[model samples]
Target: MDKPTRLIEFESMLFTRHTIPFNARKWGAERELDRSAYVLLSRIQIDGPLSISQLSQAFGLDVSTLNRQTAAMLRAGVVERIPDPEGGVARKFSITTEGERRLDADRARSIRSLERVMADWTPDEVAQFAGFLNRFNRDIERLEGRPWPRP
Candidate 1:
């Protein structure tokens, strides 16, 4: 296939079809965080406390949308508002202990699911795919001028 065509198909499968994560939360686990919470919690866990403005800039979302998401997270008891560490005018959101636990559990579950799906693949194959994905993600982040924190 041509390059553009191949890229289009890859995007179709990865996003439109949900091939990679395959909606892991629905596969198993009785208590599951919704997609927005999972992503927000992961971001908060990585970056420490973040104001709504920071979150908006990081995700390219508007403040109103973030307000709703953060409000929902507050109600879910996954995040708490705190005085900004820098004593800025805007308060920031910090992940609660429950949020940390839930995020860890959810990531573990997703990894287990990936393991099951890749059970037949060789270690080298897995490593190569992972490298490709990381590179792809990094390139996109670079183009978008929004580098994601990695550890």
Candidate 2:
């Protein structure tokens, strides 16, 4: 049998190959969403409003890149800048109702896709898969010092 470490590496690569297309798919062909908006909305939805600086720290992205993404999100009407509820000097991005609607729709679609993929798996198997994936994500976050807020 292959070493567990080697097997995991190969499986992860295969997983990315299948899932990356969810983002890397043909652009402009689908009205669903771009990955940036989905991720940003998800982050904000989970953690509340975030300043560009806060988002940078959260995602390890530079301010300029976030500016561009947030600009697109603004034009898309998915997010709005609001005075920090905590009265911080910097403005923070908050998801609009439209953003919540879009995020919910996309998440539901993703969940349905996963359901089909795991249809044959028993409930215990699904639960175990979720537990393992969560642990894997937490370890990566711990090593990177960029823990994501979970809801």
Candidate 3:
């Protein structure tokens, strides 16, 4: 009997491989902040100050994991915890001035990386691709029962 055919998903593999190298370079260049720290900072920058619980829900991480992550961020002076002022038992976490600086640097680095990758693509093509990527993310979120921006 012939051997069973193997299924291939080149697109998934290609994208995953691309990110592995991209994030490796990113993490290597910015040794002060690990990838999770960067991601948490970025989320705080976008979502504003939020309680640990809120962050836990958003990231789907448990409280203990978030607590450790936040503690490291606090020690690095990247984030500060303050009273929620919204009637919460737990304090809220906000990006510190240093965090903003780091975030800006990271954003610039990311832009440079993207520019290098898309140097051959036209602005129109980039825009279309970005739109498709956004839509794809939204669709995935929907499938996972997550809320996304309304049209």
Candidate 4:
């Protein structure tokens, strides 16, 4: 097959595979956080506090959209706005302890789900798949000039 044709196939498979977990109704029911909240909480936990403007830039979302999202998170007690730790005047959002607990629980559930799905796979196969996914994400981040902070 031509490279272009193979790339198209890959894209289709990617989208299809990505939806599997989301389509799992049982898993979805177990989630306390929605997609946007989970992503925002994870980012805050990893990158430290961030202003709405910063998050907007990072996610390519508009400030108003982020404002609504953050407002919801605030009401849920998942995040709190505080003065920027870097001595900036603008307030920044930080994940609350509740947010951390929720995120951690969700992460554990995701890992367990993945483990169950890959139960038949060899350990090396699982490791290799994870490595490839990480590499793919890093390459995309590099191209976008938005490298995520690594632990």
- Displacement of the residue 14 alpha carbon in candidate 3, Å: 2.8
Better of 2 and 3 by lDDT: 2
For 28-99, candidate 1 gives per-residue lDDT tens digits of 644457788998888999899999999999999999999999999999899999999998999999999998
lDDT of 4: 0.85
**RMSD per model, one decimal:** 2.1, 3.0, 4.5, 2.4
Model 3 misplaced regions, further than 4 Å: 1-9, 20-32, 148-151
Q: What TM-score would every model get versus the actual structure?
A: 0.89, 0.91, 0.81, 0.87
Candidate 1 stretches with Cα past 4 Å from truth are 1-4, 7-16, 19-22
**Pick by TM-score: which candidate is best?**
2
lDDT of 2 at 151: 93
lDDT of 4 at 55: 98
On residues 101-129, what C-alpha lDDT tens digit does candidate 2 reach at each position?
98887777677667767899999999999
> Residue 129: error of model 3 in Å?
1.1
Score residue 36 of candidate 4 by CA lDDT: 84
Ranking by lDDT: 2, 1, 4, 3
Local accuracy of candidate 4 as per-residue lDDT tens digits, 1-151: 9998899689969866664334445555377788789889989999999998899989888999999999999999999999989999899999999999988887777777778778999999999988977897899899998877776
Q: Any idea how many clashes model 3 has?
A: 0
Clashes of each: 0, 0, 0, 0
Per lDDT, the best of the predicted structures is 2
